[model samples]
Target chain A: MKSTWMMRAFALASLFMAGSAWAEVVVKIGFAGPLSGPIAHLGKDEEYGARLALEDANAAGLTLGGEKVRFELVAEDDQADPRTATTVAQRLVDLGVRGVVGHVTSGAAIPASRIYDQAGIPHVTPSATSPKLTQQGYRTSFRVIANDLQQGTAMARYAADTLKLRKVAIIDDRTAYGQGLADAFAEAGRKLGIEVVGREFTNDKATDFMAILTRVKARQPEALFYGGMDPQGGPLLRQMRQLGMNTQFLGGDGACTAEMLKLAGPALKEGAYCTQSGLPKTKMPGGEAFFARFKKRFNMDVQLYAPYSYDATNALIQAIKTAGSADPARYLPALQTIRFNGITGPIAFDERGDVREGGVTLFRFENGAWVAVP
Target chain B: MDILLQQIVNGLVVGSVYALIALGYTMVYGILGLINFAHGEVLMIGALTALQTLGVLERIAPDLGPLAQLAIALGVAVPVCMTLGFLMERLAYRRLRNAPRLAPLITAIGVSFLLQTVAMILWGRNYHTFPQLIPTTPLEPVSGVFITPVQITIVVVSALMMAGLLVLVNRTRLGRAMRATAENHRVASLMGVDVNAIIGATFVIGAGLAAVAGVMFASNYGIAHYAMGFLPGLKAFTAAVLGGIGNLGGAMLGGIVLGLVESLGAGYIEHLSFGFLNSSYQDIFAFIILGLVLIFRPTGLLGERVSDRA
Candidate 1:
């Protein structure tokens, strides 16, 4: 009787070990952005988007190498500073993340891209729009949003052709993203025969723009183009109005946010326009369902770039599934040529790791909400 | 010419706030002989406190007039900041009073960071749109020169507060005691004056000024955040030094001059640099002036002889 009981115990232990061997594998993916600064809201938005995607993927019971896999997101705060971004990237690499989903600002993304490339970890930026981010020729660097060159060109053309403006002034906040977009806009504006009236620059942290506006007022431009985030853009518009400068205001994706409406208040009621780097939500393939599901899960409205971040995360998962491996080296090749119908639109990368079908959308402030302009 | 006039108006409006903050730095340095680096953080706390108070008032008493709401917010912020100022000196600076001069300065910086971190925890890292209690609609005092009612209030309130501070310092018994304590701590104590109490009073008074400056700043800019006080604080410190670190009149003078220079510099920097540079160089003017002053006339514009300090 004792020998039979011992034999049964040994048999049960082996069966349990076999069951454990077939359990799900956990894969870590890194997300880095300014999680604790002025732009923390935007970073948190991107993070939630990635989290939703991972949760969905887990619910779908993904399998890799014939074993169930679970995706874990490791988020880091880069503070939107370039020096900190490189350190965060190394930390993620050290933590054994197979892929990364951010380094949100272009200033942060460009520097961090070098570290990811060196470590052989493929990273995709959901929002960083500076052309230099992808132009560095890093195989590991990919961006889902349209670059500054494309968005800037679209805004300049809209101003010149649609608005029928002959003269425009430009101002930038002297940040990597802001200055790059302004430069692209200026180049495009000159090519379209629009007379550039004034060019001014301010730091990102400054709130006062009375002096700049005073000078711009003297130039008497028909419209003004601002290349900066909404924090500065909103105040600039308010100050412009206070100075009695009734000029049309235009901005790139940075200034085209719901937060801008609150910041600019009554000032935005007249002649404000912006361009976003993707198609409007109504125009996207799976936008409605994604938004509804997101609201249900997060209990908050999607700010901006959340959809792109969701698509980026899904692309990484798809690439991992296609390669049938969790290793970075194995899935990188799959990621290079991965194609899918994302919520934002078709998701495919060209040789430079830029989305093949990047679209720009124009928006105007109507009834205190951003309305897409056809 | 009209642009120049408008820039001047902008400069004066901004300058008055700087002067208000500068008074805090000057008075503290006057009595303690320590540069309170955390003075700026005090301004931030003041603004945030007012913002919090306003939020509560809006919920509890929504029918209050804007001016009354503002007055109540200022009342709460002033006392809170005063208490903070008193605690800072008693808890942190008092222990390091006899240590090397650098000790108190470093401790002040540490205090500043601590306050900022605590604020970040309380308020989170988002910029709050400070409600403009004062109307922001511009009134053209002169043709092509626009000034808002908020701007006028900032200037008028600052001048009145400065005048009140002057009378308190020059015409009150407390002021005499403060002057004695600043002259010699031990001698002031020997003369039966409560040296500690006088020093504490000085801090409280200065903090009150900073609270007002904080509200004015947020009202003018229409936004407030955890890090908002840092730049203005540094600029105010420069203003104090430009006028002479411990001199009251000098701080006011330095603030207006610095503000005018900055505004005019930003307005015409492109032309001044012959198009090679632009208004982004606006921050360079303050530091450049500080450097020039330190090298040429360290006594500052209104500063007396160094021998008269003690």
Candidate 2:
């Protein structure tokens, strides 16, 4: 009598769980980024993008495998530290999230990718641009943004061909993103026969670059390329101007943002160029409507990676719908082969899990804003 | 030669700010035998407050001239920082005065972090572009090397403040009281000096110096943020120790020397390191000098003053 009752109780519990699963599925999508530290602004920006995507998808009544699904964002703060990133990734995986949207910086993303790869979860980074991220050969790891290779080549070509500049000085912050972009720029500049003059490095925490600027000034390069984020880029620009070395300044996506303008202020001059990884917002598919909706929902302007992050979330959800299930293992293959038009562009990953034909848009700091270089 | 001269000029400008900040560290250490780790946060607070004041002024009085705006910002920053310093001593440091030395040291660190978090929430984490009141026109007193008006102002202003500080510490009745307290707080108390009030005054004066230094730093660098204080503060502490902790003249001398070493060392590090290290490794100069000074002369360059002799 006791055994029969126990069996019946177990059966009833299973039935209730199945019923709930049938009624509605809550799919958790993980997001890991620096939410609390110095780079928290960028992480928060991407998180908001994912949040908006989730809200829109649920409001539209997303259905996967004939079950109405509510997409949930499980945002984790990696603090932009690589070690913390791995822990965050494991935590998200343990939480049984179907997919992930970010570990914003290349430094954090590279290490976190291993954790996601082991868990067999589809992880999409919206903003990390190191070419090595995809080169790791992880089947589940993918990026929505163009890698540094494209950015660096474009920057080099712009310097050599568009501006007709030959000599360039390179300064990197020595992080994965900064150094990788600088290395790529140097390689491309060398290939184009432009003189790669005075390659220097500073750490990310540094505020002083006068010594490096002075050295770069002595070399008298026609252009200065800094591969770092806005904080360092801003001060470097100011110091460069102070040293009276008014060279054409070029940088990769790290230095290309609205915040850069605020940080650099009057130091930002015309003819300063930067390359971002996607098409201009106006040029993206359904970008204008999305931006309008985003502003209405969040009451803030989109920072650098919001559109890409929005697309990343949508693409993950689309893959779930395509696979007819929210299980990461079941949907990941669908994600690999998924072809969907997204806010940024047509979202399709190549075999290496890099966005196919990822676009690079050139921008110039003009009239106190970043304007597309016509 | 021109590059050397230019780096020296840069060093001196930076060093003067260090001297101003170091004076605060030395003064507090002299009187209380405490490190006052939050001294750097005091600098950060001053800069951020001034920036906020300038922001308000810009919005309310767009037609205000840059000089007037600067004067008003400084006027606001100094008093606010003075109050912050006073409150810090009263609330955080004063309680731990009789505790184990380690207790106060840890509390100082905790106070530093607390201030950073508060400032971060208040000002946001991103670097705000501090308005440039001083023109950045390069004045070439020497060929092939350029110095901005801002740099000159930093040097001149720091020099004037240091001179004024020397006069205050040596001439006034308050100065005598401060010196007596630093020499022997218990004896000075017995001699009718208000030991607590003098300590508070020392913090206020140091905070005032920090406010000016903070403004100069932000103005010279053209950006300001919450974390901006940590590095300058650490370097300034080094300057204080290097100059002999309790000596006013030593603090100024130590700051300039350290600055010159950093500037010249950064310019020549690549050659010195046989092409391995470069200007990017400029931070190493401070640590190296600090280590060398601690090893060779524990009492510091000018010699430390012992407040209590058992």
Candidate 3:
């Protein structure tokens, strides 16, 4: 009787095998960001974007090399620190992830990109905008967002041409990202013949700016451009208003977020401008739909780089499909030339791995919300 | 001239907060001869606790006056920090008192990291927006120079607290006992000083002062985070050492001097360096002064206790 039962089980196994012959492939994509620091909110937002992308791709029944592929996200926290970023990048490479989407800060992304390049793994950063990241000629490094060069020029042109502000003062947090952006803005401002009145610097950890602000106030510039994230930018705005500077405030994408609004509180003045490195949410290919879906899934507003992350994840997946394999060796070439319309905009990389035809959208704080400037 | 005056005002306002925080360091060091590295974490706890309390109060009693909310917040922060200080003394520092000096110093650092981690878990790693209680209007007593009402309040409140602390440490029997213990622990114990209690009380009082300073710091900065205490704590320690590590008045003097140097250096760094250096080099002033004091005058400016002993 036992032999007869075994015979029946063998028959059932044979029937199941005959019905389906394809083996499923799991493609692992690594995500690295500061999941546990002052900017953890932005990091987590990037994580959620990658997670949602994988979920949607899996739901769509993606196939690679004629095998049903299920995309998986391997998330790691770099603490928004440069040293930690290199260590985590090595860990992700050791885990044999096909690709990585992350590194929310320029300081971390630059170092981590070298590690990925050495390991021959493709890394796409959703946020970090320092121009030096791509200038290093690391074939493995790619950026989905516009570099600070594009952003600074756009901001400078808008200030000089639209608002016609001539005299400007600049402040930076003296970080790789902040200094690089501030330098670019200053260069552009000078080229446009705008009189640069003063330049000052502060570290990222500083909470006080009275000494620097006082000196800047003495110049009485028509506008003030700050190159730093929201944590510093918001307080600077508050102090500037308190000191009655009444000058226009502008910054790059680092200061362009709903979190900045909250940080600035009532200090957020009307017509305070920021440049985001993509089309406004309403103007993206599927931006409005993506925003609604993201809000529903996460129960929180997108802080800043979530949509860029979503595009980055999709771009990686598209490259894998274009190569018809999940191996980094096979897909590295495909990634260089892949093009797809993303939630942020068209996704295509230049020779240096920067987004091609990258766009910047200007935003103004009005009535307690960031409204897109036409 | 106006810039110099403005910078001095900025320096003094910032220096006072440093002075308050430095007092705790000086007192603890005076009694125990140990640099309480975790004193900074205590300040962080005070600020974060106050922020959390204010958040809850604002939600439950939105109609409550801002001043009342601030009072309640401080009321919660002070005791909580005091208890934490007491526990730190009793549980961690007390056991290691008889051990090698390095052991307690390392333990203090460990305790500091532990508190920071716990705070991160409880309050989150993001910067919480500190509620504005006082008006933020800048009062320009002189043209081209600005000082806010909040800054004025910080200066006034810290001055009052310093005066109160002076009375507490110099005008009471408990104060006499504390002074005796600090002078010589063994002899003071033999003289019925309750050396252990005096040491414990110093920690509690320091924590209480830190709570007030923490509130003022968060108010002045308009934001608070788990890591907020670190820089201020280090600066305050520098102030303590500059004034003479165990001298209360010395801490105040050191803090003010450090603040002035930092402000003036940042304000004129370009002119000072022929456009090579900039205000970004502001934090370097503290370390430079700290090194100068340690090398040139180990006894500090007004350091009487240690100089007498040495």
Off by over 4 Å in 2: A1-23, A63-67, B306-310
- Local accuracy of candidate 2 as per-residue lDDT tens digits, A121-152: 88899999999999999998999889999999
User: Can you give the DockQ of every candidate in the order shown?
Assistant: 0.67, 0.50, 0.60
The better candidate by lDDT, 1 or 3, is 1
lDDT score at residue B19, model 2, on the 0-100 scale: 89
State in Å the error of residue A257, model 2. 1.6
Q: State every prediction's TM-score relative to the real structure.
A: 0.94, 0.93, 0.94
Per-prediction TM-score, chain B alone: 0.97, 0.96, 0.96
lDDT of 3 at B89: 96
lDDT of 3 by residue, A143-193 (tens): 999989888988999999998999999999988899888998899988998
Docking class of 2: medium
After superposition, which runs of candidate 1 have C-alpha atoms over 4 Å from their true positions?
Answer: A1-24, B304-310
lDDT of 2 by residue, B148-245 (tens): 99988998999999999899989998899999998888999999999999999999999999999999889888888888999899989999989888
TM-score of 3: 0.94
lDDT head-to-head 1 vs 2, winner: 1
Candidate order by DockQ, highest to lowest? 1, 3, 2
**Candidate 3 Cα errors over 4 Å, as ranges:** A1-25, A63-68, B305-310
Question: Which one wins by TM-score: 2 or 3?
Answer: 3
Q: Model 2 chain A: which ten-residue window has the lowest total lDDT?
A: A206-215
